[model samples]
Target: MESHERIQAACDFLLQSPPGEINDVLNDVRNIISDDELLQEGIVPALKRYNLAQFITVDVPETNHQSIISEAARLSTGSEDEESQERWLDPRSKKSFVFDHIALEASDPQPFEPNEDFETFRVALEKASLNYLLAHFHDGVSSAFSNQTTPNQFILQVVANKYNPTNFWSGRWRSEYIVDLNDHTIKGTILVNVHYYEQGNVQLSTTHSISIALPPAIVTASPESAGTKILALIETEEGKYQNSLNDTYHEMSEKTFKSLRRALPMTRSKLDWEKVLGYKLGAELSSSKGAFTSGFS
Candidate 1:
């Protein structure tokens, strides 16, 4: 086994190297650490695991042939006619070169300088909301989901962020409980946006903004209880909307039927349904009955 000091020295050298010398540092690391140890310590295992052969390499060209004696003497004497200028190697002259690193257009890496600000009270509610769903909410067919990313990067945020979460790339019915954390017994609008698009131009989506006050004992309640309560609140809001929509549809149907019955557009008169119903009822009742029950035939 290698000594601890030896490993420490090697690691220090690697960490000390500048970005320009990273490739050379990697080589040095390989030489200092045996292949087996390298694999154990996660140095070379990446290459083996991926079955990788090709790699990006910085330019390391061979030295050019020596210039003629006259040319060498002139360079040693230095040029006096023109000012000195920076020189650069032309990539086209080289045998081969790698393409520059690939990057998507308009893509910006996430910033880390501003240490993630965790809203203590807000996060508590968010966690509680998630927990409540996990512990208590159970739909026989549909399942619930919370943001699987880091706690700092959840869908529920204290303030609106400039972002466009592309949810339509995936197609399916999904119910996610996202918190809108706030400081109150009454929480902010929890979101249940059911969105999806499929082939054949079929699509469906709806955003359910639910608001509710937590139980006095929610803080004392278990996470599961809290999340479940959140879900319950969402369901309650949905139920209210469902009833409202149904009532509206009923009213609309009644109004439409009345308008239809009032008069025909071209004929401007209602059908004589009294006489028609009278004939229909008389015929229908005596359709298969005897003379005793058949009246006014």
Candidate 2:
């Protein structure tokens, strides 16, 4: 399928569909495409490129002091006697017992904490998983575009108010370098970026370029599956058109992946585009003049 067709398919999928229809779209496309590379990379990445932000909320079980200890004992110990002994002797163990609700507040695009407890620590895990999905989507797309796996040169830039200046907090300010220790009202912005080159050179575009914005969240549920869930949504053509796309996706993914591997590595770095580029990818975009132009100026 041509790039134009792909773009049209994406727009159609997004336009008429309600904001809550991510799951059906995913399933509809999933049936049409069999290859994993085509499904993940070509399809999903395309959605993100079109300025979609997926929002999902995970239901976390809140615990108190007693419940935390009980749950920990149930998880860590096999025998009942061992659990009892550990609970009796461990002070830190006692602290672990009382887990409660964690608050993630969006204040100043950062996670702030006035008071923190063990219940709030789970936010770190959630953030990590969210980031992991973002990474996975990128990898899936890069691999699909090219036949080979490419090193993720994409840098995740995140801005938050809380940082550790204390000597003990050294190196903890960076993503993956440090973990989010508190869950109290966590709010922040994360930007994922990558560099694109064509035929061993940057695809310099004096006339037209591409940019992206945050995508909205798509929620899905199944009575047979894990109940309610939210995840990144991707779309593809249906029936014959869908089959054609799958074929193109398979072929293109191999070539794209191979090219990516041979080309320059996308170094892991982040940039604040709003500040550095003086423009947002989606909000401010324009097209080159019609094909009547003779050549590149």
Candidate 3:
């Protein structure tokens, strides 16, 4: 079947059984357009809608993580313009976040133990990354997180579905690194993606990739020593995005949202909150009693 048709069918399947497990839903998409390059184009939105709105996270298959690396490989090879790359590569666009490149270089590449060395490096980095991610992105709220380490890259994703029983707010975070394993030296990019949904109140989402340069001897360093440096790297990037989220959230809640709940400005200027609330509340409440008391009582 065609890609759009498959996507539509997947959407229909979701609407029919919205509570289907994330893996199951993704598997269904995988069956349909598994060969198409636009695999994420269909699966991502379907998964986002289904996972963000309907269900808490489940065991996301390791294939899901590897697919990201595969996508990175595709993006690197494709000759598409930067804009197209961003549109397809970005997990979300609500915040217009962009990705930065990460390049790992080596002065003297050496042949080392293959799988074992990669595994050691991957485990050390993942262990440190998960800890930092929880500290920075999670804000102490309990979230479902996954870190996948491969010979080529590492991916860490976090999903938070709990809200004030309203199901109005949902969020997910993902970070991935795509690396080129060249004997001893490696090269690649690391990216962080965040998506937040607030029904009626806000929807703030973006995936920004920041460029990071890996140490030349990263693959050769001792696991402990490598982890320490990688920990510092994760700390730097996660810290940057943490600040971005904070600032954007403030802008959204403090400025952009006023139009949704506050009185319209008639003179093309900001509305006087004091006067608007006073007049609106005064007309509805007995001025002799506190508005809260009168309304609740």
lDDT agreement with native, every candidate: 0.36, 0.27, 0.44
Question: Which stretches of candidate 3 lie above 4 Å from their native place?
Answer: 1-114, 137-164, 179-201, 217-220, 259-297
Candidate 2 Cα errors over 4 Å, as ranges: 7-16, 46-54, 60-297
- Compose the digit string of candidate 2's lDDT tens values, residues 1-297: 764465457545643332234445656755655444555545533443222232211112231111111111112224654422222111111222211111211111111221233222223333333444365332111000000122211112221122122321211011111111122111223222221323342211111111222222211122111111111111111123335646865887679666776443376345554575554533344333333353554
Per lDDT, what order, best first?
A: 3, 1, 2
- Stretches off by above 4 angstroms in model 1 are 1-141, 148-176, 180-208, 260-297
TM-score of model 1 (CA atoms): 0.28
How do all models score by TM-score?
Answer: 0.28, 0.19, 0.45
The TM-score of candidate 2 is 0.19
Candidate 1 lDDT score relative to the true structure: 0.36
- Count of clashing pairs, candidate 1: 5
Pick by lDDT: 1 or 2, better one: 1
Number of the candidate with higher lDDT, 1 or 3 = 3
Q: Name the candidate that leads on TM-score.
A: 3
Model 1, 91-161: lDDT tens digits are 11212211122110111111112122533333444555444435534411121122233342223221111
Best by lDDT: 3
How do the residues 1-297 of candidate 3 rate in per-residue lDDT, one tens digit apiece? 776887777666654332223445556766866654566555444543443333233221221221121232122223554423331121111011122211111111112222443455555655665566466654321121111334445433333232332553434444444433343332223332222334443444455775566667775678667766766765676677778879987998778886588555677577676699887887777655676777898
Span of ten consecutive residues with least summed lDDT in model 2: 139-148
- Residue 204 lDDT (model 1): 26
